[model samples]
Target: MKIAVFFVGEVRDAGFNASALAGADVATAEGLAEISIISGVRYDQDAIRARLAEVVPEVDGLVFIGGQGNITTPEIAAQYPGKKFAIVQGQKTGPNLASYDVLQEDSAFLAGALAARLTQSGTVGHLSGHRVPPGLKGRAAFVAGARQANPDIQVLTGFCGTQDDRTVTKAWAAAEISAGADIIFTMLNDARSGAIEACREGRARQIGNAMDWVEVDPEVFIASAIARIDLGVKGAIKDMVAGIIPDTPVHLGLAQGDFASLSMGGDVLDVHKEYIAKIAQDIRNGTCTVPNTYDGPEFQP
Candidate 1:
């Protein structure tokens, strides 16, 4: 089967896009299908629609990479009902479409808890590039987790508007730091560099998402919310190859092996790790639930 993996941003972003591309590579390497990548589309509705119109006819199926697909992909999928469709990190589903979400919120909540425990100023920050559902859920989970760990801890959250613009992210990060946030949790793509620079210069530590930022930069990252977006991509492609369109969304969380979890740096204390572990278990066992939405005031950068 000829399948096209669609992405809105640069696939080599070393973050969310990169993880999804890795999954596509795995699927193609497994001989499951002839996978082609359709990437570099800006975060624009008309551009995405035009690209989809151009690509859908040429491929047997299309697997969209992120929550961005929740809108255009479904509209396009409905137009092409005979063609199979899937969205990794998406919330929507249909008879001819499936959405696979690797619950990054699970780990984001843990990051919030850790940040609350580690913060000396009693204020932590959250900065993401987009206002998408996944990022919103992550922000909500982080806030919920921090409140759970320390009710008095303050969370200053913002969406800076671009996933790849370093200047914007840096400005936002610096602003958050200046506002007494000693720890910041960031969900960004290539723009993460901007946050790292701001954290380094401001003497603030950071928590990252998508991939393990702690493994990438120990000095800047105190922890990373590991969400296996790659697995979701691979699963979507594998299902497409098998000609199986799931009736329900494919939901993978901390309980589902290593699909989602938190990776801490050397700065994290043993006691904190134990606490996070207990919380993870509670979430898995249905004793705790992570919030999937945030309606609070947004920090303007």
Candidate 2:
């Protein structure tokens, strides 16, 4: 299969692409496919549709990573047929498109739960990047999970409204830490480095999003909320190989071994190993539900 990856802006900095790209690489390793990248996707729907129109005909499979996010309406896919589209972290649905919706709240909740347990000050902080529905869902779930662990646990939440301004994000983290938030979930996208730095300097712990961060800073990072975008990519590719391009969006979450999980590397994790396992099972079995998004203010300790 000759597949082209649709990158929203620069291919180098797209956080959602890492796992999908890894999936494509895995298919390439199996000698089943070749990968090509397409970039410069504008946020506008018309522009994105046009861009896809220009690129779709050339590739056997079209994978749009973070292209206009979700398609609760399916007009775009109908306009482009024959070519299969694998959308990672998107909510678009259509016969020609296989969209992957990674329910990050599951892992986010786990992160919140863990954070609740870790804090001696009864306070934890959450820092967010750009506002997207899924991102909002993850943030809300973090608070919910923390509260689940400790009803009295204080959650200090804030949004930078931008993903790359490290200085600004660092300030946000600093403020939260100063307020006695010992652990903060830095969902500040690319600006997370600054928040992590702040957490380290303040002697406050930090949580990772998507990929593991322990190797990056073991002393500061207690754990990472593992969002399995990789599974979405790999699964979509296998579907492509099977000769069927799903029109509906595929939901990936804890139930399918794609649970946004916390890494088992930390000593604290070992302590909560049983709890984590039980919770994972509950989430997988549909006994426990994590809200993807919630509406609220910046909660304080």
Candidate 3:
């Protein structure tokens, strides 16, 4: 079956779009489904909607990656009865729309613990594109995880003002590094490449989100928190193909290989795997509850 995904940025995207594309490609290769991706640069909601409107007829289903507010709203989906809809990072308003969600707090907790255990500088930082839900929740979980490992470790935060601006993002990372944050978890979408560059220049290790960036730069990007949008997309497509798509939102977590997880690369600190695994287990079992937001200081560049 053929599927279409409406992404809010260019094809060379870094965070969510890239991961979803990667997942879609893999799904096609594995014979699960075929996917066509369409992008409209951020904020051109009208143009994006027009593109999707044009592309929808050619595919069996349409997946909107972060387009709930732009491409199609609950009202819009309600108007398209026969069109199968799956949304990555969207709200569930009614039947025929499947919303894919990532349980980021679990993986962010893992990342925080990893950062605190490895940082030579006693301070860890989070770089983001906005002070929004998943990013904020991830950063907050990171802080909780870090403190759970080392109670006194300081956490730094910064925002790049936009998801696609690398210059601003890179500068933010540099400033965070100058403040002695040796490990940074970047959730800045396409701007993450900038943070990775900054980490390399500062000789600090980095953690990425939404993809298996364990080897993005073996030296600087030593860890990644996976938000597996690809898996979510693939699963949603499979359900659509099978005519069993769920109308309510689908939440993927540690138990679901598709949702989120923190992976340690070979280049990172040689912390015992069991230590990290235990934290993950606690999160999965509800033994460790990760707070969903951090009311910490956030700098905008």
- Best-performing candidate as measured by lDDT: 1
lDDT per residue, candidate 1, 1-301, as tens digits?
8999999989999899999899999888889899899999989989999999999999989999888899999899999989999999898889789999999899999999999999999999999988888998999999999999999998999999999999999999999999999999999999999999999999999999989999999999999999999998988888888888888888899777779899999878999999999999999988999999878777775
Ranking by TM-score: 1, 3, 2
lDDT against the true structure, per candidate, is: 0.92, 0.75, 0.76
For 139-173, candidate 3 gives per-residue lDDT tens digits of 78888889999999988976666788888888999
- Candidate with best TM-score: 1
Candidate 2 root-mean-square deviation in Å: 2.9
Task: Decide which is better by TM-score, 1 or 3.
Answer: 1
**Residue 198 accuracy (lDDT) in model 1:** 98
Model 1 steric clash total: 0
For every candidate, C-alpha RMSD to the true structure in Å: 0.9, 2.9, 2.5
Off by over 4 Å in 1: none
Error of 3 at 130 (Å): 3.8
Worst 10 residues of 1 by lDDT: 292-301
Model 2 TM: 0.87
lDDT of 2 at 48: 73
RMSD of 3: 2.5
**TM-scores vs. true structure, each candidate:** 0.98, 0.87, 0.88
